[model samples]
Target: MTQPQDPQRSWPRFQTRKPRILLLTSQFFLLGEIRAACERLGVEHVLLDLQAKEMGLDDFVRTILGALTTFRPDFVLTVNHLGVDREGVLLQILEALDLPLASWFVDNPHLILPAYPRTHADKTLLFTWDADNIEPLRDMGYPNAEWLPLGTDVHRFAPGASGRPDWDADVSFVGNSMVAKVLGRYKAAAPGDELAAKIREIADAFGPADEPSAARFMLGRFPELRDAFLELESPARMLAFETLLTWQSTLDYRLDCVKRLLPFRPMIVGDKGWKDLLAEEENWRLHPEVSYYDELPGLYPRSKVNFNCTSLQMKGAVNQRVFDVPACGAFLITDRRRQMDRLFEPGSEVVTYADPEQIPELVERYLADPAARKAVAEAAQKRVLAEHTYDHRLEALMRTMRLTFEPAAQS
Candidate 1:
């Protein structure tokens, strides 16, 4: 998790006991993993429902306070700042109560955090999946930003039999085509004709570049976008524009990378967008999206090779598939990222493509040699179990939190 490769670095620990955490629950997938991690570590937790968007202010406040009183938590945990509202209601309550908040971000923070208030930046510890986000988050007023990369619930993704024989394929890639997502965000932003044209040109240029944040990359490459940026007026509008471009660039980039799979006749398990993108292409099989917790575990084992191309926002970081596919004891062929060397041993533990052109060759070679794929999958699973489990990540999070916010009780 870019958690340092050296053995000599001093690490923190909970001095008194494992702290109770009040979990702000959502339908987000990571909450389940975090809860499992807490259970594994013997940490106490209680949930506060934040799933309803239309919940009144009275209910929101009452629910939060009730949880705090009952749970008596040492900290409050959230995913992607879900309960930490942009209007600062949650932030106000937490700061008033002196509860430290831990928000683990798995998405592009540039597109998410700008909407949230920064009242308790110091107390709101940010654990980002992307290491590239650390400095940017720090600049964005979260001084306590840290990197805690994605990991798998090994038991959930463990190697098992594939119940469906039809799942067996030379290659399979499970991900959104981003066609609807890009278009949705773009329409929501609703830029004027001239601004929309400028935005399109910027997204077109940004897709192929090796950059992290779309806003920074756009302004750095073309200063003129800054004027169009200011024309958006509201902070929310600016955020919407940046988010739309990010998804648009990702759609373009991912399509180019995934197109390489066409000749291999890959099985694409995703939304209708795949059909929208590759209409009537007879080469590949396009199956509707599968449930991550249930179907993916089975699908990975049957497929000879699993392909992954990350979102453009994560320029130098690995995504969940890099961890999950291996944990399933299946071979994955992913695009190379800067932080990859920190996670896997590259050629031995994992196979990577520095260019999309290399994908077909890698897929062909790996598929032809089952023994080689098996060896690499075994190696990757071993590494994942050892250093990249949810438990390991929670251990690191607890250690860091204690060092920064919690203090040991003196006898």
Candidate 2:
């Protein structure tokens, strides 16, 4: 193994044009933001949109090798887990090239089953709910891993820009419920085939529902409900009980998840499972209403209080809306996480609810003190723009990879 050298004295300085950067991501949906960030940094970027490419292993490696030869980028960035299974090809070629590679992963890499590989890049940037996971990456050999929170693109997801009217209700949310079951029927006939068919049916019907997709669907189905859902009618207390009920799952677990739903107006959004779980309850607005990304920024701000609850596996990891909604200038009351304060100034910039029961009063208090809520949102936005953006994180990556790009004198 190559021994680690002292950190670079200073980053390479280029004249006229910015650094030539190559970003290889198979996820096409992320291409726009990656390109935008590169543009903002004045970096000349060649995006190998893996979604658009159609090539075999040999062809893929050859193409990447050729791109490296022609582009001669100072840096190459990729999502930690390539959507394409054929990642070995890309990694082998990039490693051979001695390129300054940076991996940006959005999820809590620590708990993901069959963990995303970490061999190719110099640094792995990840987001987490509990900030403590930073150490494990180093323990696992990714000494360069850093905690970078997910950032919402302020340009698109803003409340004022959504063109939707101000919502009338007190609190609202706009994100999908995640599937978090690992299956535990060791004795009773498994229901394996039934489960598979049900999943297949939903996949076929909804076409792989994501937050943006769900938001768009809602906008199309109930345009007027946008405001009502965005500014939901507040429940009896400050906190609302919310859950993404995996409809087909048994009531025991779903109800356990639901116990926290009603107190805060428990606005559940996602698939038909949530509806079935609620079974025509007066508090639950079952089907997803706010579907598009562009609409989220405005939608979150309309509510006096917005609750963000993550699925079990992701409970310790901060969701995109943790930053997105608040960055949109909304006061968010989120489930407690240890890492939250490290990312945002607690009490001042963001607020966390330790118990579901606390939400209602917290909401009432924050709403009553409009100026304090606005102050908190403003501070959170400032912090997000400064430290949590893709550009900011990219700059951090550049710093981490400075050793790779530094000149002999700087080294």
Candidate 3:
């Protein structure tokens, strides 16, 4: 591969004009949505034409250098730190070019950020969808970490057309079953009985708590995991254990929540793992996963109550469904999250359950009361249009980035 050397690239210039953005391309759905938002806001931008995975420094530098010459972005943006190599090659290249990288972490930053051994506080800006993550990220060596919660693409997810007959239900939940996720990680780690027990204990404890991390929880509650974890014998294995347990915990929590919905015969759309989770039960309808762009928007409106259960990895963060379903003008009955109060007014704009036990009753109430459901759904749609669209988020991010970084550029 030919490499570009000593490239003369323009640094971040947060000037009077709308700052041009160089959107890092990835396999993620968010990247496409961000591109649409950029177009909606009439922001000048370019998507780097390159796959981020398994990329070497030479190819990365060359591609970014090629884009910089043309796009000349004030900042390079990507979600969940896409295009960022674990070895820090991308960070080093960007830092050398004096280009600031704004990474929005939609997933758990704890699981993702630790893999980056090389990062610069000044050259990188971290935004998290979880408000609870802001302080923790600041503690994790990123001083300028900001809260940027996920928002719906109002134009795409808004209420309009009728959904497919097959997709219609009293309640619907669109998400991965986490069955394969937990199993794959379990097989990869192959922990011994003692370590596996440690995992089980941590996961059981982790699933119910407000804390997002079992590792952080273990420091205070369980001491024996340290010795048991040493048996794994590699940092990769340890990280695998962390990931495995998190998924396992989520699967445990989700399975329980979904089981409660079995009485309602909820239409579940996601990976085939759901069949495995609901193998014995014949009540619920499970469909293969649908595309976010093609089907989910239509599917959300068909359900009187769109069920939501957050992942254990996200302790306080509201999942995408909290925004998507409501934005579609579909009523939602979600498990209560700590940040629900800020984004939504539970019991009115959106319905929330404090526990799994409360789910069935909430579902029954909302499903029975069509007028209440419509009112709540309409209220939620209004709120989403006014505040939680990608338009609002991108505009806010543009203003915040300029206010936060423009002075630094001039300095």
Q: Report the C-alpha lDDT of model 2 over 1-411, residue by residue, as the tens digit.
A: 222222332123332235677777767665577688878888788987667556676666556666767777776766645533433555555555555566665644542312334555453334332444566656666656566556667666554755345453466644443332322211121333433334333323332233212223344554653554344333211011111112222233234434455655654545555554466566656535565565565567667777666543333456777778766777787776656766888888888776656666777687689888788888888888777776776666566556444554245
Off by over 4 Å in 3: 1-12, 53-56, 408-411
As a whole number from 0 to 100, the lDDT of residue 360 in candidate 1 is 81
**Candidate 1 global CA lDDT score:** 0.82
Off by over 4 Å in 2: 1-18, 52-54, 83-87, 110-130, 163-168, 179-266, 287-289, 314-317, 403-410
Give me candidate 1's TM-score against the actual structure.
Answer: 0.93
lDDT of 1 by residue, 130-211 (tens): 9988998898878999998888889899988454887888899999998888788777787776668776688888876877
Instruction: Provide the clashing-pair count of each candidate structure.
Output: 0, 23, 0
- Pairs clashing in candidate 3? none
Candidate order by TM-score, highest to lowest?
A: 3, 1, 2
lDDT of 3 by residue, 234-320 (tens): 767777788898998998899899999989888888999988778899998878888888788899888888899999888888989
State, as a TM-score between 0 and 1, how close model 3 is to the true structure.
0.94
| Candidate 3 C-alpha error for residue 46, in Å | 0.9
lDDT score, candidate 3, position 393: 86
